[model samples]
Target: MSKLKVLGICGSRRDESVNMKLLRYAGSMVAAEGHDFEIFYFDDFPLPLFDSDEEAKTGIPENVHRLKQAVREADAIILASPEYNGSITPLLKNAIDWVSRTSARLQVTDEWKGKPVGLCSCSPGAMAGLRGLYHVRDIMVECGGLVISEQVSVGKAFEAFNEDGNLVDERTSGFLKAMISKLLEVSQALKKA
Candidate 1:
């Protein structure tokens, strides 16, 4: 089988965000699995809040277009989200809104259709970022993505990684490995289907 291209989206904006660090670790795991991985920091996209009027006049913003192109090129997506007030961060939701707008042009007919997805989250709280993953999974399904049922949620994320961003905890690392494996399995199945 050919190598798969996996896109890792760090939905958190903080420079030292635990969620982003987890995503980096996930990328490393994907590489070990003999697949290619690219990480997209949402802060890099600079997409404006979704507005149909602006889109009508200006067409898709270049940043939005670039993000859409990335999504189009990838065979699968892994989302690293952070929970804020028991849900997904607004920044991540805003980015999703921008991507969803292009569904009118692409949606189920073109790119992103039946794409495999893996959900993950990191938080300092005790919930292990489960709420954020829950929110992202629902949104991914709405976008016609085939979300992998298994997820990686890390609690006390502040201490889960080393200074170099490697996952230091054995249990967390194992969970992340399983998550990547599941993502790859689903990705291949979706392509075959």
Candidate 2:
């Protein structure tokens, strides 16, 4: 089978964000399976708030273009989101909003169309950011992404990781692994077709 490129997107911007840690751990697992994994943190690509007038005048921002390229290149995407007020974080929503706009050169959503995706979330709260995954899934579907059914939600995220920043719970780890495997399987099938 051909090697697949997996992109890990973390919605949180904090230096020590639990969501970031979870994404890193997922990347390690994907790498061990012989797939290339790349992590994209929201903090790295600082995009201006999406504005139709600004886009009409300036076109898509360079950073947004780069982000769109990354998404287009990756065989699958693993999204690690932290719920904010029972919905997706603004940082993540903003990034998606920017990417959804049509560009002069590309349909924009074309990059996401039929793309395989895995959703995961981590939080200190009991919901484990699970509520936000629903919103994320809806948005991705609207953009034509094929979000996998399996998902991981690590609750009490403050204690979800150990000293090495690895997931401490076997169940959570297993769930993430299943989600990644499913994503790879679906992506490979789609690529062959």
Candidate 3:
């Protein structure tokens, strides 16, 4: 079988954000499985907040269109978000709003419809990344994505990795490996559907 094309979306602006490192590790895991993984830093992508007026005047932000195009092209998606006051970050929500609107090439229905998605989150707090993932999972569903049920919520993210951003904690590594395997399983199964 051919390799699965996975896209990792990091929903944080901090260059050293824990979510970014988590997604990077996920990409490595997918590569080890003989698949191709690409990381899309949502922060670096210049997308304005969704506005009907702006769309009417400027005709969709080129960068937003490109980001949605990437999402549409990918066979699977891994979204890594950070919790803010017990919910998904505004940046991620804004991006989702942009992608969910009607568009020329990548409408929400066709772009995200039935595409498999795996959700994950990272936080330095004890609650882990669960809350953010939960919020994103709902958004994915609204976009018609097939979300993998077994998601990951990384807690105390500062302690979850080494100084070099490598996952050093044995328990956390095992948990992440399991999550990646499950994501690959769902993604592979969806391809045959």
Candidate 4:
């Protein structure tokens, strides 16, 4: 099997974010599959709130270009986000808006088309940010990406993970494993086609 590159985009930018911890755990599993896994933290590369007028005025920001290229090169994406007001976080939506746009100067067209995506969410509430993930799915599909149906949402995120960043609950872990497997499978198949 060819080595596929899996990109993890963490939507929460807070220090010691539980969602980032979840992505780290997932990344380890991706690595164990003999694939390359990289996580992108919005905090590390900040883009101004996406604005078409800004794009016309200043062109794509260097950081936006960098992220767009990453998405283009990635075989699949895993997104772990915290629900904000019953919807996806602003950071993630903005990143999608930027990455989904065409950039002729950078030779980076819409990268979301045909991209396979795995969704995950962690929250302190009982709902586990599932509602937000639905919105995420909508946005991803609208951008022409294929979202995996097996998504993992862990409630009480503060208590969901152990020190190693692995899910503690056996049932949730199983769900995550299935989701990851599907993500890897679809990504490899899509790459071949």
lDDT value for model 1: 0.82
Candidate numbers, best lDDT first, in rank order: 4, 2, 1, 3
The candidate scoring highest on lDDT is: 4
lDDT by residue (1-193, candidate 1, tens digit) is 6699999887888977888888888999999889999987667667788777887777777887777778888888998988888887888887777766743553322345677888899888899879777888887788778888889898888888888888888988888889889889888776777
State the displacement of the C-alpha of residue 6, model 1, in Å, after optimal TM-score superposition.
Answer: 0.5
Descending-TM-score candidate ranking:
4, 2, 1, 3
Estimate the Cα RMSD of every predicted model relative to the unseen true structure: 2.2, 1.4, 2.1, 1.2
Q: Model 2 over residues 1-193: C-alpha lDDT tens digits?
A: 8799999888888888899999999999999889999987556778888888888787788889888889889999999989999999988988877766776554455578888999999999999999999999999999888999999899999998998888999988998989989999998998888
lDDT of 4 by residue, 1-193 (tens): 7899999998889998888898999999899999999987677789899887878888889998889889999999999999999999998999999999976674668999999999999998999989999999999999999999999999998999887778999999889889999999999898888
Q: Itemize residue pairs with steric clashes in candidate 4.
A: none
RMSD of 1: 2.2
Model 3 residue 52 distance off true place after TM-score fit, in angstroms = 1.5
Each model's TM-score? 0.91, 0.95, 0.91, 0.96
Per-model C-alpha lDDT, please?
0.82, 0.88, 0.81, 0.92
Which ten contiguous residues of candidate 4 have the minimum total lDDT? 101-110
In the predicted model 1, the residue pairs found to clash are none
Clash count, one per candidate: 0, 0, 1, 0
Candidate 2, clashing residue pairs?
A: none
Candidate 4 clash figure, as a count: 0
